[model samples]
Target: MTLEVHGMTEIQQLAGKDLGRSAWRTVSQELIDGFADVSGDHQWIHVDAQRAAAGPYSKTIAHGYMILSWGVPMFAELLTVSGVGRSLNYGVNTVRFPAPVPVGSRVRLHASVIDVQPVKNGGVQMVRGFTFEIEDCTKPACVAESITHFYP
Candidate 1:
């Protein structure tokens, strides 16, 4: 479920809030290939199914960055900010890929608002913790702390 917050006031009150998990999204070979095409990272382990079959993972794997980029859409499924002038992706504080996301796997995001601080111009800087959990996997595919600034 999405947690909708209207205006800066509601956003500011979200510190330490648990946003919960998002819907599962499948990782397809086509998606991986598209990412490779756009990123110019056509490594055989990611695009060549034939060779990847003999690789350690025994199949094509999605790029860590590709899964990281999905943070935007995945987060949108958990929270919605409204009545603000703008919401900007400030940056990522930390990120790590603990496990590979093999093709045909499913991933979901578990997000929490870790901190919210008042910034200049009456805006708030929110630090959100995101964990990209791969289905049926013991380790998470990626863990990251994303920062965003919301202006009134």
Candidate 2:
């Protein structure tokens, strides 16, 4: 769903609402490998399948950052603000890695708008709380609260 910002007041009113969950994405070895290559984090646990199979996690696991990267697109799917010319990612208020995301796992995002307030220059600062859940897992892989500034 697209978030249309009819007006500042309407956007502000979205605060305290739960945005819908995003589409499921499978975490594959290729994705993990690509992330490792770009980040230069070729840790054995994330790249070496055999070693990882014998390691504590029992399989290659996705990087924490890789999971974090999924948040943006997921948030976009959850909320679309209309009437806004631009939006800037302010920063994250908090982030926690609650559990590991194993390779081959399917993950999805669940988000909620926690707070909204007007900023200078006719912008609105929104705080969104996100939980990234691994399919069929009881614990979430990541939980974070991020802030963004929307220029209306």
Candidate whose TM-score is highest = 1
Candidate that scores best on lDDT = 1
TM-scores of all candidate predictions against the true structure: 0.98, 0.94
Off by over 4 Å in 1: none
* Candidate 1 structure quality by residue, lDDT tens digits, 27-99: 9999999999999999999999999999999999999999999999999999998999998999999999999
Please give the range of 10 consecutive residues that has the lowest summed lDDT in model 2.
1-10
Compared with the true structure, the alpha-carbon lDDT of candidate 1 equals 0.96
**RMSD (Å) of each candidate, 1 decimal:** 0.7, 1.3
What lDDT tens digits, residue by residue, belong to model 2 across residues 24-114? 9999999999999999999999999999999989999999989998899888787776777888999998999999999999999998999
